[model samples]
Target: MSAEAVSALGLLGRVELPGVAGSICTARRYVRGVLRRSGQRDTYDAELLVSELVSNAVRHSESGRAGGLVTVAVANCGESVQIAVTDSGSATCAPRIPPGQDEGAEGGRGLWLVRELSLSWGWHEGAAGRIVWFRLARR
Candidate 1:
């Protein structure tokens, strides 16, 4: 885990990772590390959810560029954990429960997975960029 993960206190943990495809794994590792250090249980699903969100940011948003950035904020807010990924996306496209994707479709299931796994999810524009967030209840 990086130093920021520990320093960004007040809501469990937070980390800012590069907005690139390769950074997805790093983000996941950071999530796992924070959860473990904080003694939060059942991180597998949270890890998966973070993976999907980061993947979407890298693939569809401007954050994938060389100098682009993505910020992942994780917070343990009582019975549930809140995770948010802010990217340098151009448009403020809100995430939705996507319609049934085609069998032949190459991609487009990331948000769908988030919808299915998270207790609740949403997106909004922020000063930095677009933010996609989700929450999962502790089991």
Candidate 2:
């Protein structure tokens, strides 16, 4: 559905989370509730994608700094689910899949997993902040 339609229909729900490591789980729980209420069957993959997005925001953005917050939005548009995570922007970088992977590293695979699971994904710099979003086809 169109962004305007999603908002107009009130199909969207959002939660603001502390930009801390532990908030990842909280974001997942909040998304779980939204997905369940919308009767989404692919909750597991959606939750995982949300976690990765939030984790990336918390780990890489200014949001992870003191007193910052991350905002997560879930939109259920009947045939698909849209999830977006907004973070305090970083002056040094934007959200992107890494150019390559170091299998030996302890992390940095999150976005790759997101790409694998999401039907479509993208990010944009907006008036509110930097937002990364993904959509999954309903089961």
Candidate 3:
């Protein structure tokens, strides 16, 4: 399915996870199960993309506040699936590919993998939080 179709379907489920690393795998599994039940063959790829987005939110956003929330939303339109992760952070840093020498580093490759795997991905600031989202074709 095409991404444009998925966006038109709107969000299927929206979940909030605490700012903890363990929550990331749980969120990925939840998204995978949803896509799988929907007969999406690209469930694994969608899980991967969601993992990147959720991990970034958990790692970068400030936690412990009453309003701190990491939100995950999934949607499908028969042709494609879209996943978005939002956090209550105003930080302006954007994901980027590191230089050649940094390529061999131990970390900082999540967004790069998302770019390589997803049909399309981007980020924007919403009224309540910042959202990073990715879309995949449904096969």
Instruction: Identify the leading candidate in terms of lDDT.
Output: 2
Candidate 1 structure quality by residue, lDDT tens digits, 1-139: 1224224534676678887788899989998887777777788988998999898888778898888888888876677778888888766455665677776877777788788888988887777788888888865
| lDDT string, candidate 2, 1-115, tens digits | 3357459645658888999999999999999888887777658998898999899898899999999899998886567888889898899988767877888888888888888
> Which residue pairs in candidate 3 have backbone atoms (N, alpha carbon, C) closer than 3 angstroms, thus clashing?
1-79, 1-138
Taking the tens digit of each residue's C-alpha lDDT, what string does model 3 give over 4-91? Answer: 4335776677678887787789888889877777777667788877887777777776532444668787887457777878787645
TM-score of each: 0.85, 0.90, 0.82
State the local distance difference test value for candidate 1. Answer: 0.79
| lDDT for 115 (candidate 1) | 86
Best by TM-score: 2
RMSD value for candidate 2 = 2.2
Error of 2 at 73 (Å): 0.4
What are the runs in model 2 whose C-alpha is more than 4 Å off? 1-10
